[model samples]
Target: MAEQTQPADMSRWPLVIAGGFFLIMLAIFVVAFIVLSGEDTGMDADDITETAYMDIVTPLLVDADPERGREHFQRYGCTACHGNQNLAPAVDVMIASAGERRPPMQAVAYIYESIIYPGAFVVPGYQNNMPRTYSDTIDEAHLGDLIAFLSGVEAEPAPEIPEDDPLSIETPSGDDATDADEEFALSADGNVILTPALIREYEDLAEFLLAGANPERGPELVIEYGCSVCHGDLAAGILAAGYAEMGQMAAERRPPLSAAAYLYEAIIYPRRNTVEGWDDNMPDDYAEMISTVDLGDIIAYLLTYADE
Candidate 1:
C-alpha cells in the first residue's frame, strides 16, 4: 500500500498560529507601556504631595521684641501672679516677697521657663493653679520676646530715711534724759552701718551664682536640691513633703515659690523672707551649701517648662 497523503487544509494551520502569537505580543507590549507610565507618574505625584506637606508643617522663625513682650505681659496677665510697677508687693497675694533682690537677667530666664513649661515647677502654693498656657497658644518668637522684657527690668531704688528731730524721738523710759539720749543718737550716727558692705557681698554672690547657670543643667539640680521632695515629681503638681501646711501659712508664708524665678530665690535666700506657714520647713542656710552659679543652673533648668 502507498503512504497516506497529508490533507490540503493543513496549509492554513501555520498562519493561524502566527496570528495568535502576534496578538499575544501586542497585548504584552501594551501592559508594559501602561506599567512603566504609571510608575513614573506615581513618583511625580508623590513628589508634589511631599512638597505640599512640608509647606504646611514647617514653622517660620521670627525676631522677638522685648518692648512688645512687656506689653504682652500686661495683656497676658503675668502681673496677676507677679506684680505691677512695684516689683516688691504683699507676699500673700500671689506675689513674691517684698524687698527681695533678684537679678533682671535671672528673672528673664525664669519668665522664659514659666511660659514654656508652666507646670514643671509649680510655685509651692500655686501648683495646679498655674495654668498650662504655652505649647500651641504662643509660638517660639513671642516667648523669646517675653523673656527679653523680663530680663530688661532693673530693681527700683530704696527710699531714703530722714534724720530724726529731737521732738520726734520716742523715749521708752518715762523719765526725761535729753542729754544722754543726744549722746546715744550721736554715737549711733557715728558707727558705720555695714549694710553697704553686706550688699556688695550679695552682689558678688549673685555674680558667682550666674556664672554657671545654664538651662541645660536645670533638671538635675531640681532633684539634687530636694525641690522634688515638696513640689512633687517632675513638678507635675503633687505636693511632696511639707505641702499640707501651705494653707495655714500667712500670705507671705508660702507665697508661690514654685515659679522658676521664685524657686531660684527661695533656694539662694531661704530665710530672706519666710513664707508665713512653711517658714519652719524651708532651709535657711543655702549660703554654706550651694553656690550662686548652681542656683542659676536651677533657674535655667526650671525655665525648661515655660513653654510646656
Candidate 2:
C-alpha cells in the first residue's frame, strides 16, 4: 500500500539554465576584454621595446629603419671586406640570398642572425670573416634596424615616445646589477672591456683634456648618438638638474675625480658615481660612440656648464 514515489523535479531546471547562461556571458566578456587590452598596446613579442638587460635598447622589429642601417653599415666598415674589398660576398649579395641561406628561416631573422651570430649559418667558400664582436661593439640595440635595411623592408623607425610614456629605457631604476660600476671601470678611450677579474687596467688620464678638443662639435655628437634620449634636449633648455652646473658641481659630487676626469668616468661609466636622486639608467656606451678627440670636446663642452 506504500508505493509512494517522488515527482520529476522541474523547479531546479530554470536555476541551472540561468547559471549556465551567466557563465557563458562571463566567458565572452573575459575574452573580449583580453582582446581589446592586447590591441591597445599594439605590441607583439617582436615589437617589445624594453631595456631590462645590459643597458641596451632592444627596439621593436617592425620599427627598423633602412637608412639608419645603411649608416651603420658604412660606419662599421662593412665595405672593408664585403663590398668593395671583395674578400667575401658583398652585403647586397648576402642580403639578397638571406632568405635562401637558411631554409624556413625568415629573411629578416636570417639577416639579424648573420649580424649577431655570423657563424650561425655560413655560406660555402666564404670563410666566416665577419668579426664576432659586432654585437658587443656596435650599437647592437638597433641591430634590427640594420637587418630591416639589409632585407630592403625599410620600415619606419619607432615613433618618438612622448615624455609621459615609458622612456626608451623601460627598465626599472636600479634593477640592473650590471649597470653598477662598483667592480669595473671603463678606460679613457672607452674601448677597454670591463671585466671582473682581480685586476683591471685603466689608462692614466689627464685632469683636464679640453685643450685640443672642439667643444662646439660636442652638442652635435650628443644628439646624433641619441644621448639626448635620456639626458633631454639641451637646446630646448631641458637638461638634467645635476648637470646644470656639472663642472664645479662634478668635483663636489664625486670627490678626488677632478672635474674633467670625473666627466670622463661619468661618460664611460655613468653609474660609477651616480648623482643623488638620479636613476642609474644612462647607457655607459658614450665612450665607444666618440673618439678620444671627440670625448675631449664633450668634456670641454660640459665644463662650460660650470661657468654658466
Candidate 3:
C-alpha cells in the first residue's frame, strides 16, 4: 500500500530542503559580519559616531578657558610627547611623522585616541611610549577641553599677507616692517594679540573638529586651550584641584551648566553669570579666541567620559 502511494514530486522535496538550509547558513554569515564589524572593537563606526556626537555636544555643558587649557597642556607633561608652541618637532617624534602622512586636521583624532587609550593604535614609526591610559591622570571634562585645544591648534593656518599690499615687503631694518609685525599680532579690538593667520587657522581647525571625521580631536583641543590649569587635569571638577570650595559654591549658585548647551554659553560668553563660589570673571576672550566649531568638538569629547 505504501509503494503504490509514492508522489511524483517527492524527489524535488529533498533538493528544496537542502537549498533552504544553504540559504539560511549564508544569511547568518552575512548578519554576523555586519554585527561584528559595526561593534566598537577598539575603533568601529559606532564608536566613531558616539565620539562625534559627544564632540558636538559636551563643550556646551562645561566651560573651557583656552588660556587655562593651554597651561594644562604643560602641567600634564603633554608637551613632552606632543611638542612645544609650534607643534613642529613633536615631543613624540615618531608619531609626528606618522601624523604628517594624514592632514593635520585628521591627526587630531589620532591624538585624542592616544590620550585616552594610547595603545589602541600604535603609529608604525612611533615607540609605544604614550601612557597606557589617562583614566587616572585626567578626568572626562578636562579631557574634552584638552581635545578642544589640540583640534584648534591643528586648525590654525599660516598667516597670509596680501602680495599687493605695500607693507607686505617692508624690510625689518626699517620701522615699517616692525610696525607691521606688531600690528599683525593685534586683534581688531586690540584685546588679543593673535595674528590674522592664526585666527584663520583657528577657524579652520574649529570647522574640521566639528565635521565628525575625527571625534577624538575634540578632546585634544580642550587640552590645548589650557583649561586644565584652573579646572584640573581633566575638567572632572575644579574642586579636586584646589577649587573645591568654589566648585561647590558654583554648583549651588549657578543654573548647572554641565552639558553641551551650558558649556557653549560659557565659552562664548564666559562672564554671563557667576557660579556660587566661583568668580564671575571667567576669561572674556574665549568668545574671541574660540570658534563655534571647536566649542562643539569640546562638547563632544566631554560626553564620552563625563560623570553621570
Q: Provide TM-scores for the models.
A: 0.26, 0.37, 0.29
lDDT of 1 by residue, 1-308 (tens): 22236565686688899999999999999999999998788645335332332242223113556555554453333433344223212223221321122232134444444555555444444434444534444546656656555544332222111112222222222232222233322224232122444345544554555565796776565456544444544432322222222212212322232344344445554433334222122333344445667777765555455444
Structure candidate 2, residue pairs in collision: none
Better of 1 and 3 by lDDT: 3
By TM-score, the candidates rank as 2, 3, 1
Off by over 4 Å in 1: 1-200, 233-265, 291-293, 303-308
TM accuracy, model 1: 0.26
For model 2, the superposed segments whose C-alpha errors exceed 4 Å read: 1-142, 145-204, 234-239
Using lDDT, give the best candidate's number: 2
TM-score computed on alpha carbons, candidate 2: 0.37
Candidate 3 C-alpha lDDT tens digits along 1-308: 77458785885788899999999999999999889876638455445543563574366226644334444554354543344223223533433343453343254455566566666666555556555436555655556656555545433332222222312222223221212243333334322343456445444544544566343665466556645434545333432222232333332332333343334444554433334343332433455345656666665565444432
Between the candidate structures 1 and 2, which one is better when assessed by lDDT? Answer: 2
Model 2 clashing-pair count = 0
* Higher-lDDT candidate of 2 and 3: 2
**What's the C-alpha lDDT at position 69 in model 3?**
42
Off by over 4 Å in 3: 1-62, 83-108, 153-308
lDDT of 2 at 188: 52
Q: Rate the local accuracy (lDDT) of all candidates.
A: 0.43, 0.56, 0.47
Candidate 2, 101-126: lDDT as tens digits? 77666677667667766776677887
